[model samples]
Structures are given as C-alpha cells and as structure tokens.
Target chain A: MTPHDLKQQAQQQLAQQASLDWLSLPQKAQATFAALDMPTRKTEAWKYTPLTALLNTPYFAHTAAGQVDESAAADRLGQLGDVSRLVFVNGHLHPGLSSYSDLENQGIVTLFSNANDAQRELINAELGTAFEPQQHVFATLNYSCIEDGVLIQAPTDFKVQQPIQLVYLSSGEAQPALAQSRVLVYGAAGSSLELIEQYDSLGETNVFHNQMTEISLQPNARLTHLRLQVEHESLSQVNGLHVKLAAGSHYEQHALAFGSALKRNDININFNGSNAYCRLNGVFLSKHKQHIDNHLNLEHGVPHCNSDTVYKGFITDSSRAVFNGRIHIHKHAQKTEAHLNNKNLLLSKQAELDTKPELEIYADDVKCSHGASIGKLDDKSLFYFQSRGIDRATAEAMLCLGFVNEMVEQFPNTAVIELARQRLAEFFNDVDQLNHLWTLE
Target chain B: MSKTPLLEVKDLVAEVDGKTILNGISLTVNPGEVHAIMGPNGSGKSTLANVLAGRDDYEVVSGSVRFKGQDLFELEPEERAREGVFLAFQYPVEIPGVSNMQFLKASVDAVRKHRGQEELDAPSFMKLAREHCKELKLKPEFLKRGVNEGFSGGEKKRNEILQMALLEPSLALLDETDSGLDIDALQVAAEGVNALRNPERSFIVVTHYQRLLNYIVPDYVHVLAGGKIVKSGGRELALELEEKGYSWIQ
Candidate 1:
C-alpha cells in the first residue's frame, strides 16, 4: 500500500477503538491530510524549501524503543538542572529517563495514551483545536498517526514554579525510520507554566522526527515556552507549534534551531479573545548544504491584543533558509498592536535566504509594522572588533554569535540560554572560520 | 646619547575614497612627551589618527610611520594594537552582543598573549577591571553591559580611557576625545589619561579645540591645516592656536 493509504488505514483503526475517544480527531485529521497533501515546490509556503530528502526517503515505521541510551539521556537531563524532565527515546517514553512522576500523579503531565478517563476527556477537547489544519499538512499528518504523546494541563489558578523540560531523542534502527510524537498543553484560567523542549539525536542517525506541540491558554493564563533544535544534522525533522490565547492571556515563545538535511517548523499563534499579548523570538542557523524553513502565522481575531515577533537566520556555505511571517488582523481586531521583524545573515556568496513578512490588516485603528533584512555581517562592526586587537576569524565568530545572541539573551530562562549557547557554539564550530569560539568565554 | 623617537612620521600622505585628507603630514613624538595636534574641520586630524592605527579604508598613497623602531604600516590593525598602539576613537562603535568586560578581556588577552605574557585568571581580571572602573568614576556594572551599548557620550570616552588603562599601550593616539565631553567628564577622562602617562609611553592628542590641553598638558603643539603641519612650537603654540584659530596659520 502507498504511504497515504497506510496513514488512512491507521487512522481508521484508531477511529474504531471504542476505548479511545480522542482517536476521532485523528480520523478527521486523516481526511484533512488526504485533501491537503504534503507541500511541493509549487506551494507558496514551500516554494523556496524543497523537501527532497523527506520526499525521497523510504521511511518505515519505528521499531519499539531502539537502543535506549539510559546513561546518555540521564546525563543530558542532569545537565539540564532541576526541572520536570520527560524523555522519550525512539517515540517511546523512557520512565527511567524521565523525572516527572509528581506532575504525572497530579494529572498536570501525562501520556495521552495512558491518561485516565477524565483526563482523556480533557485531552480530547483540547488535543487538536489550537491551529487550522488546512495550512499545516505536516501537523495533520503527525496527529493522524501519533504513536504516543504528552498532555500537560494546568488547572485554574495553578502556577508551576519550575519550567517543564521535554526531551525528544531519536535512535534510529539500521533502516530509515520515522518517529512521531506530540505534546498538548492546556493552561486554565489564571494558570501559568513554562516549557523548555529540546530535540536532539546522536551522530549520523538516520531518523525523521515528526513532532507537534499544541498549547491553549485560558483567560488570564500565562505561558512561557522555549524550544531548541540542535545537534542533529543527519536527521530530517518536521515540527509544528500552535498556540491559542484567550482573553487576558499571555504567551511568549523563544526558539533556537539549527538546520539539518530537511528541517521545517510551522508556528501559529491565534488570539481567540481580546487583551491577550504574544511575544516570539527565534534564531535559526544553516550551513553545509543544510536547509531550514520557518513558516509563522499570527492571527488576531479579537481586539486589543498585542504581539511582537523577531526571527533571525544565519546561512553560510551553500545552505538555504526560508522565513515567512504573516500577521492577519480580522475586521474587528481594532486597537491591535503588532510588530514583526526578520533579519538574516547570508554569509557565503552561494548561501541563500528567502524572507517575506506580510501584514494583512482590515482594522482601521490597528497599529502594525513589519520589516525584513538580509545581508552579510556589518563591516563596521567587524572593524570595531579588529581595532580592539581581535583577529578577523575571532571577530567574525563573535559577530555571528552576537547576532543570534541578542535574541537568546532575551530568553527568560537562564538554563535555556546556557543550553542554547552550548549548542550554538557546537553548531558554529562546524565551520572552519568560527572555530575556537568557546575560548572567547 | 640620543634615543630614537617613539614615533616618527615622514611626509605622511593618506586618502579615503579618492579624497586626500592628510597630505605630507610629518611629525615626531618622543617618549614621555605629549604632542597636541590642533586642526580645523577637514584638516585630516582624524585621518592621521586612523592611518596610524592602520585602518584599512584609509589608503596610504605615500608616507612612512615608524613605531618602536618598526614599520608601522606593515602590521595588521590588530597587530598594530598588539605592538603597543592604541587609537581612542572619536566615536566608539557600539558592539551590542559583546559585553564591555568580555571585549576588554579579549583585547587584553590578545595583547598580553602577543607579548608572551601569561593570561590572567577570571578573578584577577575582574579585580583589575573593577579597579580601573573605579579610577574612571564609572560604575563597575558598566563592565557587564554591551560595549558602549547605552553609554552616554562622556561615559563612552571614559570607557575608552578604561580600555587604555587595561591595554596599556605605549603609543596612544587620542582622536577628538574631548569633543563630546563637558568639563567634568573631560577632567575625569584627562585624569584617566594622565594616570597612564609614564616615561615609557607617548601620546599624540588630536583635537578641534584646545580646551583638552588645559587638563592633560602637552610638551609641544603642532598646527595641521590643508593636510600638513603648518606650524610647530612649545606648549605656547596650543595657546596661540586657541587665541588666533587655524586661519592665522593656514
């Protein structure tokens, strides 16, 4: 059978499971996936990003938890410091590697498949309702055949002190494999939570990790989310994050991503109620024939919601990066304030960056501005460093780090910043000129 | 017995973007002596400072500058910095990502490494930096911020002096350092510069106004106009230029 047929069959089987009510959403998503298939070059959203690796890869379903490196996952979590860390290896949760028993017991965090009856009812309501499926083919595909996923719910007036850490690790078998996992968060009224999710794999692992995360913030709820995609150049990744904010809610997201063979991220934020605020900051890097694409959409359906977003990209050595940010204000989204900015550094002559920032506003009283810039490092800044007795290579490295470090410094979580710096140093060290960057510390 | 001048420039001719700024500018600065170079606008005062620091944009059409008995033009800008040459920029570039302490530490390490000196430990470096901050009347917290990120004009000049104290260059070039400062800041900056003065160090102060000379007294003064040194005299020349202005010597 074809991949599409197999996906439909899985969804049909899930739909028939009488014990699992959440499977109904997957059944619907499967039909949506059939209608809106994987994007191709002709698709406007996927024009500059060719999914050659993903389209050509003969991906087979993942085997049960392959080669779980207990020590490695444990060591990584230890380095991440004190947090409710949940680790999944090869699409299977590793209870020994995870340390969120307290959260799991409270029903604040639990596996979607293993949730209790009441918890399952809550998850069923919030599982697939954050973003529109028509624009996100990968997310629909992921939901249709999700193997196992996480569900985090913060009840009314509940405030979590520590940021929750989700560690998604891939350990591929000999054959090319696809591992799909997900996370759904429901922040109830007056609730707040912080999340730090990391996606990583070991050297040369041939794994395509398809993951999705959905978050819903009720009125007066606040959520601070951070995502890091680093240290896996050989893998293919398609990830999506969708957030829905209610009245008087707040959402802030920070992402630091590195390019791989084929990496695409679809981020969507929808303001369903008024007086909600959103802040998003993202930095992406690509080099050595890698490709990274970020398609972001901010929807303002209500009034008095403000959003500020900035995403920066650094492409070098024949790498390609694509950024599309769209802010859509409905007819009644008056008094809405929005700003979007994207600045990119195209290092090598052959490197390419395609950026488009669009503001579609129907509200007459709204204030909105958007701008995108793509260029090489500033010569004046380089000269400034050189004048201070720094060599050109070191100066370039500093400047490159500085470009991305600006956004990274704004992250509210210090642990995430430290982790990002470590990963960024490692990612930049791949290029010859940016070596010895760690010595600058 | 005679000692070689710390810096010797012979018929220095320079240009930027096809525009000749300094034409046949020749001067000498001996050790422990401060030479004030008074000039009007468009007289190559800043260009001379830039060329001495080996700025790449300023092309040396013809001339030679010898620092510490070596060809100054042959070294890279960083190398020139390592070889005890410091140019306190008129407008210090704001580097947003690099913190002040980090930039200063990197710079100090580069110079120290080039001089074959051992690197300072973190604690030692912080202690020394805080001491310099106190000396400049700058809050130690400024060291934690980006280089010149939000510093006021006077604060930036004092930061330059702080860097000067840390790098401890032998040949210092002050380019329009006092233009943006009020009297109090100028005194603080001058006092910072004066503290670094020693028998092994020499300074070439380039300024549009002679008020800075009142704080950091100069041994000799030269008037640069139409791109060349039109007149030279003792400390009295700065006073003369301050009284009569560059049009008298032009």
Candidate 2:
C-alpha cells in the first residue's frame, strides 16, 4: 500500500472514534497533512531510508487495550529513584502504574483532558507552531491522528525538583496496531525541568508508534532532556522532538537510541531569543538489518546564541544508519557560535553509515564549524587486547561498547547512566560476536 | 626434572604484506635465562616478538614453535597468552574509556581463570596493583586512568613493566621496552622486570642499543642482521656491540 492510502485509512479510522474535546486538533491537522505528499525515492530527505517495512506492516488499525503486565514493564526498566514517572501502556496513560502523585499535587503534571482552562489555552496555541510544516511532512503527520496526551506546564518561576519521566510501553498484541503519543512541556520563566522519554516494547508484538514531544522554555528557564529507545526488532518508531528556547533559557539533550526494523528521529531546535544555549550529545547503535535515521536542524534566529552537537554511531552486522545535521544562522544572528560533529564506527563488512554535517551561515561574523568522520575499529588496539588474553570477540565488543561508553559517561544523572549501561550491556550481548564482555553496576 | 626448553623456535620464517621479515630464525630458551637480541634498523627485531605473541599481520611462512611441549602456532593469540606467553609492546596502545584498573582486572582474571585460580576481589586487586604502581614510580592515580592515556614516554614503558609483573608469564618477549625511557625510568623499568624474574620464567629482551642491558643484564646476546641471527655470544658481545656498533658484528 502507498503512503497516501495509509494516511486515508488512518484518517478514516480516526474519524470513527467517539467525539472528544480535542478532536478538532486532528481534524485541523488532517487538512494540513493533505497539502503534503509522501516522500518517494526522488525525495532527497527519504532517499537512503526506505519505508517499505513500515508500509508493509498491517498497522493502520488500532489495538484495543489488552492485558498489560505492569510489573514486568517495571522490571525491564529498573528504578531510577525518586522521580515523577508517567507510564503509558498501549497509547493510554496508566495512572495506577505511575508514581507522579507529588508532581500532580504540585499541579505541574496534568492530563490534557483534565487541564485547567489557561493550560488548555496554551496547548491549543502552541501545539503545532514548533516547526515549519512543509519541511517536515512525516513529523507533522502526528497531529492528524492524535490521541490522548499529557500536558506538563510549570507555573512562572516554579521549578521541578526531580526529573519527570514519560514511559511509552507498547504491549504489542497479536494484531498489528498503530500507537500515537504526544507531550507538550512549557517551562515558565525561571523554571527548570529534567525530562526523560523512554520507549520500549512491552511484549513481542507488531506495533508502529508515532510519538511527539514539544518543549517551549520561557526566559531564563532551563530544561535537560534525555531520550532512550532500546532495540526491538519487531517495532517501528518515528519521533519528533521540537524545542524552542527563549532568552537566557538553556536546553541540553542527551540520548542513547537504537535502531529496529525502522526508526527515525526528527529533532528541530529554534532559538527565539538571544543568550539561549543548547548542547546535544547522543549515540545510536544499529545492527542486524536495522535502520536508523537522525535528522537534526538548529536555527539561530537571534544574536549571541550558542549550540553544539556531538552524535556518535556504531553500526554493525549489515545494518544501515543515516545522519543529517544542519545549523542555520540567520543574517542578523551575529556572534552565534555553533559547532556540529558526527563520528561513526562501522564494525562489520556490510554495515553502512551515511552522514552529512552542514552549516549554512548568512551572517558575516559567526563562528561555525561542522565535520563528519566514519571509520573502523583500530587494528592495533584489537591486537593489544588479544595479546592480553582477551578473546577477539570480547575485545571487539569492548571496543564497540567503549566507543559508546565515552558518551554514556557524560550523561548528567547517575540513575539514567545506570539504566543506559544496563540496556547497553544487554544489547551488545545479543550480538553474535559480542559475548561475556559485560561489567555491569 | 624435565629438561625440555621453555620455548623452542626452529626455522621460523614470517612475513608481512608478502615481505619476509623473520628469515629462518632459530632460537631456544631455557628456564631462568635472559637472552638479549641486538640488531640495527630493519633487522626484524620486533617481528620476532610480534610473531611469538601471535599478531595477525605477520604471516609465518614456515615455522615450528613449541611451548611447554605444545605446538604454539596452533593456538590463538589470547590462547597463547593464557598458555603463558606475554609480550610487552614497545608502543602501548592507549584505550580510552576503559580505565587501567579495569583493563588489568579483565586481563588478570582471564589468565587466572585459565589457570584454575580464583579471581581476586576489587579491593585485593587494587592493593596488588597499587604496590606494582609504586615500584614502577607511578602514582596510585594512574590505576584509575585509561590504559596509557596521556602518559609520557617513560610512563608508558613503566606501565608495560607493571603489566608484565602482574601477568607473570613464563615466556616474556620484551620488544624495545626501553626505547624511549630516560636513564632513571630505564633503571626503574629494569628493576621492575628483575623483580618478576623467577627460576621458572624466561626472558627474550630485544633492543637496538645496549643501554638497557646495563641495568637488566642478559646472560646471552645475539646479533641479528637481515632477519637472521648471524652471531651469538655471551654478555660481553653486548658490550662489544655497544662500543663498536653493527659494523663490528659483520
């Protein structure tokens, strides 16, 4: 089936749902989506990442919420202590399985249905304005089939003391399903928040998740975001994270993601005010016919703003990965300091990495640099390890994991780092050549 | 006691990129002996060490090597190391993100487990490693750093010696371990090696100059020219080479 037919089927399925307060949002977005066409091979953006598997999967129908093993989901993702966590099982919020009572009491974490009048008004205003609609057809397709989502709004100068976590766990039922989740975070002036988004397959099922996370920071507000997507060979996920930073606002994001049958992430950041800063660092691992595409765009609209990006990828065993990072500096954006770099390691005979690090500067006096490097594991290092009684398989695993652990160590929180390490150990061990090389904490 | 040589290499020929480096090299090492191999540039000194350590780039065209009455070339590199062969690299590789303590722990545990010995606890390993660090003039902080990361030339040599001491291999082939060290660091490295010398261990010290032999004196010296050992003599041969250079050897 073609993408247009899938979109038509999705719209029909969405129209048949019971009328709700937020139904107008998707109805308005369907018109917007209709104006855009699906990307084909001639489309420069989707040339390398083919969408055959996603289209082949019979996933237009929504799965009725089945029996979800709450405890098993919690066990797979161990405790990251004392944080406000919201658990979403099969596209709906699972309140009994979540522990955000304190945050709810603070009136910061609320469901969109239960949001107060003012908060609802803000959501209505800022839902779809995070990015230009034309350039991002797939990401913009999220609102057309929207369902229930969370609204996290911090009052002016009200800082969140602990990190807020949104866990999207899919209990892929026997039938194929389409799972959509959304989140809108507005950090008021002088407010701060640390948000963690974790996506995992709750069971062995066929599911396609279209997830969106949009964050807007007011003046002097701060946000630290972390994203993790553990490998699920049977899963297909597309995520768009749009962030807008006001004057004196700081935004930092660190992600450790993996590729599955198909995975794409479109991250767009707009600096609306001067003196806003952002630092993005992450690592993505792909193996065994998996495909991952990361497209990042940073726009420096104002002067005296700064942004830096460092993304590393480890591709092995016939997998494919694509990375495109662009930094755009406007004409009046003077003194804008932007640097973007991407480093990759191809550890197999057939693994592939296609990277393009670009910088477009319209200003005369801006400091910007971008570069990309793709390489293999050093042979001398491998020999050094083998000479020390470390087997070749273990040595290769160590080197590959070492390439990623360099970024893992830089993660800001210890609990998040622990979880990353645990998942990494498990992921690496699953590879055929990587065996018995884990030293977990 | 058995009289078999600790290591026996006969008619060993090896090459890299189709260029033969070790041409018909023959040697024998008995227990409790240090054999120094002195050669000028392009004389296959390091090739011998690499082949003995089972590096992949060097192809052994034809050779017969036996260690403790077992065929050496039949085992993989790690298997060779586990079977009591150790090579102190002339240029140690600096591995980032893996701490020196972790690297040593993994190596030590692998060797110990292969020998049917119990793995040491973290505290126990730390104590053992710290003592070796002090002896090699390395601060305890070096243990927490990445392996050879940002270390000076002399420090990398000391780290190699520290590893040799911990692994305690029966056959140690040191390839120019004293190349870039200062006199003081050379002396410290030599002392560290001498401390690991035992009755059952054998050493093959390969170098270009005789400066290191002054500290860790060898029992025998061999001069290699064009991938073949042309002359063999006692300790005084090193002195003669040091005084007159390879011109005197020919």
Candidate 3:
C-alpha cells in the first residue's frame, strides 16, 4: 500500500478505538503524525537502516485493550523482580501484573490516568518541552498517542530508598501490532529516584514498540535511569528519551539493548543549568540479522555542565549496529566539558558497525572531544591469553565479556548490574567457542 | 644426558623488516638455571624475547626454537603460552576494559588446560591470586581495576611479575622490565621476580641494566650484541659489567 493509504488506515483505526481519549490532545499532534514521512533509506538519519521490512507488514493499530495472559506476563515480569513493577501488555495496562502501592502511598509514583488535574498539567508542561517535534518521528507519534503510562514525581527533598521498575511486554497474537508509551519524570530539588525501564516480548509475531520518556530535573536532583530491551528477535522498537537538567542536577543512564529485528534508542539531553552532570553508558549485543541503532545528542547550553558517554557494540553473524553521538556546545557555554567515545567489536566478517562521534563546539573555552573506533579484539591480548594455553575461542569469549563488563560494572545499582552481567553471560554463552576469525580480535 | 635442555635455541636467525635482529644466535636453558641475557640499547635483547614468545612480527628466516619437546614456531602465540612459554613484555599493552583478575584467570586456565588440568573455581582462584598479590605488595583492589590502565611504571612491571607468578611458566622471559623504574620499584619488582624462581622453572632475564641483576641474580650471564651472544660467564659477569660498563665488551 502507498504511504497515504497507510496513514489513512491508521487514522481510521484510531477513530474506531473509542476507549482511547484521542480528542483531548492538541490538534497539532494529529497533524504531526499525519505529516510524518515514512522513514526509508533515503532519509539521512535512517540511511544505513532500511525500513522496507516494516512497511511490508500491516501493524494492528494499538488500542486501549488487548488479550493479556497473566501467567505469561508474570513470567516476563519475574525478570524485573518485585521492585514496584508496572506492566503493559500489547499497549494496554495489565494492572493485575503490576504492583506499585508503596510508591503510590509515598507519593513518588502516579499513573498518568490516575493523576490529579494539577499533576496532569505539570506533566503536560514538561512532556514535549525537551524533545523537538520535527526531528524524531517516533517521538511525535508517541506524543500524539499519549494515553497511559507511568508518571513519576519525586517530591522535593525526598530520597527514594528503592528502585522503581517499568516493565513493558509486547505480545502480538496474529497481525503485527504497535504500542506508544509516554513516561514523564519530575524530580524535585534534592530528590532522587532510580528508575528502570525494561521491555520483553512474549511471542514471535512482528510488533512495533514506539515509546517516549521526558525527564525534568530541578537543582540537585539525582536520577538514575536504566533501560533494558530484551524483546523477541522479530520485533521492531524505537524508544526516545529527552532529559532537561537544571543546576547541580545529576543524571546517569545505563541502557542495554539486546534483541529485536530493528531497534533504535534516541537520547537527547539539554544541559540548561550550571554544575549539571550526565553520563550515558550502554552495551548492545546483536546477533543473527538483528539491527540496533543508538542516536544520542547532548546540548550543552550553559556553562559548567559536564557530560560523558561510552557506548560499546558487539555484533555477530550478519547483524549490524550504529552509534551516532553529537555533543553540541553553544558560544557562551564556557567551561562546558563533554567527552564522547564509541567503541565497537565486530565478531563476524559480515557484521557491520557504523559509528560517528561528533563534537560541535562554538566556544573556545569549552573542553569538547569525541572519538569513535571500529575494530576487532586485541590480538596481543588474545595471544597473551592463548600463549598460556587458553584456546582461541575461549580467549576471545573472555575478552568480549571483559569488554562489556567494563560498562556494566559502572551501573550504581548492584542488583541491576548483576542482572545485566548475568544476561550478558547468557547472551555469549552459546558462543562457548567463538571462532577467532569471527571476532575482530 | 644433562636432563635435556628445557629450551633449545639453534642458530636462531630471526629478523624484523629486512634487517636481521637475532643473527645466528644459539642458547640452551635448563630447568634449574637462571640465565641473564644482558646487552646495550641497540643489542637485540628485546628481539630475542619477542622471538621466543612467538610474536608474529619477527620472521624466523632459518632457525629452530624448541620448548619442552614441542616445535615452538609451529604453535600460535596462545598455543605457545599453553606450553609454558611466557614473555614479560617491556611495554605491556594497557587493555582499558580488561581487569587484572579476569586476565590472570584466563591466562592461568589456558596454561592449566594445556597441561591437562581442570580450571580453578572462583574461590580457589581468588585465594591463589590474593596470596600472590600479597607477596608482590600490590593492593587487593588492583584486581578489580583494568589491566595496566593508569598504572605507574613500577606497577606495570609488578603486574607483569604478578602474571608470571600466576602462570608459573616453565620458561619465563623478562624483556627490559627494569627500564623506567626507580631504586625502590626496582627492588620491589626484583623481589617479586626472585620469589617466583624455582628448580623446575627457568628464567631468561633480559635487561640493559645490571642493577636488576642485583636482586634477580642469574646463575649464568651472557652479553648479547648485534643479535648474537658474544660472551658467557658465571654470575660475577653481571657485577663486572655493572662496574666496567658494556662499552668494554666491544
């Protein structure tokens, strides 16, 4: 079908779904979705990734309700543990599988649908302010379909002792499906919250998950956001997170994206105040024909804002990965320090990684540097391990683990770091004997 | 029958690029002896170390190196490692993301597997590593940090010796590990090396300075120049060379 036909059909589906309060949104959101040019290879941002496979299938327009098996959902929720879980199956709230009463009572967590009018207005004011509407199509689509998601609000001077886990499960029955999620986090001054976002797919059907999360941090507010995406290999997903930081605010992000046929995570940060710190750390493992892309941008708009990012990619088989990070500093943003580095290891000759780390600085007083390297394992290190008698395969495997463990260990949360490590080990477990030639090492 | 030399190097003619570095060199290292290969800056001391470790850079034009009855050249670097041949690189590559414990475990397991031994579990490995680190005076926290990353000149040398202690290779080749070290670091590194010496394991201590020999005193001293051994003598040769300098050797 043509692009116009697809848009028309999607609009019709949304109109038929009366359970969703679609008319409440500003009229401009509908126009934004209508005008979105279906991403193709022709688009510069999606140049290396082609959307031909996604366009070929018809996705069931996401509705307010769908079939959600509690047993299957619980199985997926088990991975996140009992830490304040929020479950969404096939784009609908599976409240039976969610438990966050402690957070609700403490006034730290409030679902968007259940929030008061004042809280709703606060969330609406902060939602689309950080992310630009034109650049990201997925973010625009989420904005248009902003119906239900978790709204996290940490009161001023309150420090949360436990982590809040957000779990999303995409279970497609027959036709391909799509889900749009909106997450708004407002951390008041001197408040802290550790937020975890996890995605898991129950079935093998092709599903598309589009999500947008907006975070606004006041002065001295510390936020740690960990996003783990381990969905079915046939799913296509795109998650966009936009963070706005004030003075002395700290934001730490650790993201691990392992599955899905086509996956991309866009993180855009605006450093608006002084003494703000942000770190974006990620580890991505792709095998088979999976493709994962991470597009991150940090705008250092004010002085004395520091940001550091390290994203590692390990691709095997015919899989592909892309890491594009741009750190922009304005003219008046002096003493703005930012360092961005992207290192990728290709385990297959056919596996591809296109990494571009860009630093656009207009201030001569700022310290901005960016570097990207694409290579295989360290042969000298491999030889060092092997000369002692470790086989070539085991040596490479150990090196690969060490490579990813470097980033995983940076996670401040102990349980999350350990879980990520376990998953990483299991991810590499199959290649017990990784071919020496398979790794760049 | 002289217990069959643990390592035999016959007319080892190896070269880097088009220039011959180890020109017609030959040596034999027995299990119970410590051999010091000392030379000046341009002398092919490091070349011999690299060649013995089976590095791919050097081309063995026409020669043979044997370690424990195995064709050293026929094996890969890791294979050579498994057969108990270890080289203490003068400039150990700093692997930014690999930790000291992880690297040591992998190396030890490789060597053990090659000798038909089972791998050590976490507890045993940690216990073993901690013992070695204590003797080396290295902090236990170093095990958690990346290998040689942000390490001082002396720390890298100590780490190398620590690795040697863990691997416990039959033949350990040390290549100019004394360079860029102060007096105290030299003693610490030397003390670590001296502790690893045993009757069944031999060491080839390659250095440009005779100071390292003060602690890791070798039983045999050989002066290497122009990629070949020019002179051989007892342990006193190290002290004599330190007194007169390598200039008189010509």
The fnat scores of all predictions, in order, read 0.50, 0.62, 0.65
Please estimate how well model 3 matches the true structure, expressed as its whole-model Cα lDDT. Answer: 0.81
As a TM-score, model 1 comes out at: 0.94
Q: Please give the lDDT score at residue A385 for candidate 2.
A: 87
Candidate 3 lDDT score at position A156: 94
Off by over 4 Å in 1: A1-19, A60-66, A116-118, B244-250
Q: After superposition, how far is residue A22 of candidate 1 from its true place, in Å?
A: 4.6
DockQ of each: 0.64, 0.50, 0.53
Give the per-residue lDDT digits (tens) of candidate 3, residues A1-441.
655565666676665543234225434566887888767677888887757556776663544245677887676664544488777776677779888899988767887777777777786677678977888876766666555667898889899877888877888656676666777899999999999988777767466777878999999999999887877778888888899999999999998888457888889999988999999999888988888888899999999999999889888888888889999999888999999999888889989888888889998898778998888999887766665566777777767777777777777777777566555554555654643312211
Q: Residue by residue across B1-250, what tens digits does model 1's lDDT show?
A: 5778999999999988999888998888888889998888988888899899878888999989899889998899899899989999999988776788888888899989999999998889999999999999999889988889989999999998998999999989999999889999999999999999999899999999989999989998888888998889988888888899778887
Categorize the docking of model 2: medium
For this target, which candidate reaches the highest DockQ against the unseen true structure? 1
DockQ of 1: 0.64
Superposed Cα deviation of residue A358, candidate 3 (Å) = 2.3
| C-alpha RMSD values across all candidates | 2.5, 3.7, 2.9
lDDT of 2: 0.86
Instruction: Write one digit per residue (lDDT tens) for candidate 3, span B1-250.
Output: 5688899999999888989898988899999789999998878989898888878888999989888887888988877777788898898877766677777876786678778889898789999999888888899998878888889988898899998888888899998889999999899889888888888899999988888888888999999998889999998998899899998896
Clashes of each: 0, 0, 13
